[model samples]
Structure formats: C-alpha cells, structure tokens
Target: MDFTAILGAWIAVGLTLFILSFLYRDNPLFKIAENLYIGIAIGYIFSITIYNVWIPKIYQPVSNRVFTSLSNWVPWVSKFVTPAGDAGSLTPLFPAIIGISLLTRIFPKISWISRYGFAFIVGYGAGLAIPATVATMFIAQIEGTIQPVFKLASGGAIDLSGPALWTSFSAILLCLGVIVTLFYFFFSLEHGKISKKVTKIGIYFLMVYFGAAFGTTVMGRFALLYGRFFDLYTYRTSGYYHATPILILLVLIFFFVYFGKSRKTSP
Candidate 1:
C-alpha cells in the first residue's frame, strides 16, 4: 500500500509490456528497450571486470608494493629480499607478464606475440580435459555399463538364481552396442561384409540415440519458451497493471501483413 512500492510495481508492469511488444512485431518501443538492456549489460560487465579481476589481481598487488617502497616503511623486507638486492615485498612478475602478453592480442602489430599465451592456455586446458574425458566418459561409463546385474548380499554372495543372468546379458549387449556404434564412425580400413552388417546395426542404434538427444533438446527449448510465457501471463494477471504487450505486437504484425497484401494487390 506504500506509494513508492505502488509506483515501482507500475514501472515493472510497463517494462513487461514493452518486452512482450516483441511478439506483436518489431516496433520502436521494443527496440529502445532492447538497446537499453544491452547497454546496461555492457556497463555491468565493465564494472565486474574492474572490481573482480583487474583491481584485485593486478593493480592492488603492484600498487601496494610501490606505496610501501615510497613510504620507506620496511617492516619485514628481509622475507622478500634476495641475494641480488632488496626487491621488497613483491609478488612474482611472471604471471603478470604472461597476462600482459595476452593483452597484446588487442594490437594488430604485436598480435603474433599473443600466440604464446594462446598456446599455453590451450595446452593447459587440453592436458586437463584429456585425462578427465578418458576417466569420466570412457572408463567410468564402461564400468557403469558392465556392472554386475546381480544383487550382492552382506554375506559376500550374490543371488545367482534370480533375474541377474538376463539383466547382465542385457547390460553386456548395451555396452557392446554403444562401443560398436562409436567405432562405426571410424573409416580407416575397409570393412568386410560381416563387419559391414554389424556396423549397419550399430548405425541404427546410433541414429535412435541421436534422435532421442535431439528430441530432448527441442523439449528443453520449448520448456524455456513456455516458462517465459507463463511469467508474462502471471505478472499481467496479478493486477500489477494488465499491459498485454504481446497483443500490441500481434496488432502491429497484422497491420504490416495487411499493408503488404494491399501493395501486392495494387501491383
């Protein structure tokens, strides 16, 4: 019931309507809102870059050392002092130097120097990813697929006379299907007739798997769209100022369509 709160609620309703205007058609109002959103996002990113990364990691460390040296306040200079000279309380410069080298990519003339930075980053990323991919996707998946289908009791024995045999056989078949389907894509050597037949079966399984994955992705996209529609509907229905921006957008779209039709009829 607060006046400020009521004003804020109305503003939210107007903004929601503006966003929904996109569904009707591309209008000046929607374009303005879209541009404002992009500008705000860019401003946020710039602020976050300075606060989170640049200031803390680079500026503060170097600035602190410089200030301490100028102040002539060597409280514990012995820790950082080396055999060559009193280097003062300063962090290692190698990381900063590498970071600077990465920034050189912004310049057209010295962009080649950034290749070392790219190589280092790529090499490190690949080194980590290769082992992780092998362990998780390859080894762990293989282990999961080939696990014992039988239920083991606390007495260190499995129920052998149950449905374990059938389950185990199915598991083995599934594992083989996945492996063979993956190998079917590799065309280094010519496959014989029997091998070709097996690979064709593998291809069918692979197709089914890929189709299911695509279907799932499509469902996920639809779900996201549905959620956005729900949000628009709920906000409008809450009596927060019923601005059916989508209706306006639809009107605009129909107007354009009719105008185009009229032009075509004249020709």
Candidate 2:
C-alpha cells in the first residue's frame, strides 16, 4: 500500500487505542480522543452543509444571478448557475438571513436577536412534523391494529389452519396490548380494582417493548465495537506496518510514565 495509506492506518489505530483507554479509567488520552471526535464531527457537518445545502440552495442562486460575469470567467461556475428556464428568484435569502441570525447567540449582548431565528425554526419544524407524525404514527397504527379484524370479518369461514390460528392469536394480543396501554395513560378517572388489573397488563406489555428496544440498541453498539476491534486486528499485520501493536505499546508507555510521575509527585 501507499505510505499515506499506512500513515492513515496508524493514525486510526492510535485514535482507537486512545478511545479504548477510557475503559481502564478517564485519562488525558481518552479526553483528547473524545474532543477530537466531536470537533471532527462538527467540522464534517459544517462542510457538508456548506457544500450540499449552502452552495447549492443559497450561494449558487444568488451568485449566478448577481455575478453573471464570474460564471463566464470560471468555467466550472457555469454548471452550478441556475438555468434561465428555471425560476432563479432570491427567495432563499430569507432563510439564509434567519440562519445567520442564529449565530448571534454566540454573543451574550446580542443573544436576544437569535430568538427570531429560533422561533421561525421551531414554528416551521412543528408545522411540518406534526401532521406527518399524526399520519404515519397515529393513523397508521390504528389502521394496522384493526386490519386483522377486517381480514377475519371479510372471510366467509373462520381460519382453522396452524398459521391462521397463530395470526388470529397475534392480532388479538396486539389489540389487547394497545387498549391496555392506552388505558394505562388515562389518568382522568380513578383506577378501580378492575382498572388496576388492566393497567398491570399494560405495564407488562411496556416492559417487554422496552426490553426489546434496549436489546436492539445494545446489539447495534456491540456491532460497532466489533468493527473497531476487527480493524485494530487487521492493522496489527505486517502489511499495515503493525500499526495497532506499535500504537498500543506507545499508549501503554505514555500511561505508565504520566501516571507514575503524577503518583510520585503527590503526597
């Protein structure tokens, strides 16, 4: 492989070791790695927004219209210039101004100005999201729950096969789960003895749902951990100049030296 490829492998291995050091204890290496991760992520997101959103949506439209001469001078700029056939209005400038206003939050004295930007964002986001959420979640969920009942009703004869029986049982269980879960959240009326029993069933359904969700999340995390470890193992080979092993040794030496000095200095 190329020298740059090897260098990149070494850097990756070193950073991975630095992050893994947190498992032993919270140390300078871990903090350095953590901050680097966050900083890199923010920088990457900003770059993506500038390229994908800012340049395409805002900058290109304004520049193409206002600076038509530059488009002739720079051949590549001509490609991004909005065509005459398309509507090249400067309407996008409003949102651009709102986005800039949000930066005022960084200055304590002028932070109040950021509220306008925030208000627009919140209002627009909620207006867009609420209807979509209701359509996809509430309506879709109700439709799905009652779908099996409709299927059974439409059928002339009852289903007696093993698969059909299983489906029927599942539909009944799902409906029961939904009803009890809704009742569990209904706090207006006092919970009579019967209501308490129904709510207890809801609790069981909720616990099962939460446990499954947690398990899926844990599995996802483990998959990431496995990928990192696999990369580290691959880097330990001679092809990568034993990047993982060398970095591991360096990290171990640094921890011992730094912590040893600190312990010796302390009373």
**Per-residue lDDT of model 2, residues 31-95, tens digit only:** 99999999999999999999999988997776556656556577777777544434354778999
Off by over 4 Å in 1: 1-42, 73-96, 149-166, 245-267
* Per-candidate local distance difference test: 0.71, 0.88
lDDT (Cα) of model 1: 0.71
Instruction: Write model 1 residue lDDT over 1-267, tens digit each, in one string.
Output: 455754665555555556666776666667767887799899999999889987676666666666567545664653664223233335635566766789998898999988888888899899999999999998998788876666666787875754766777777778788778966986898898888887998998988889999999999999977876675565554354443454446546755776577679995
Clashing pairs in 1: 24-249, 24-250
Give each model's clash number. Answer: 2, 0
Q: RMSD of each candidate?
A: 6.7, 4.5
Highest-TM-score candidate = 2
Worst 10-residue lDDT window, candidate 2: 147-156
- Candidate 1 lDDT at 204 equals 89
- Relative to the unseen true structure, what is the C-alpha lDDT of residue 53 in candidate 2, on a scale of 0 to 100? 100
On a 0 to 1 TM-score scale, where does candidate 1 land against the true structure?
0.69
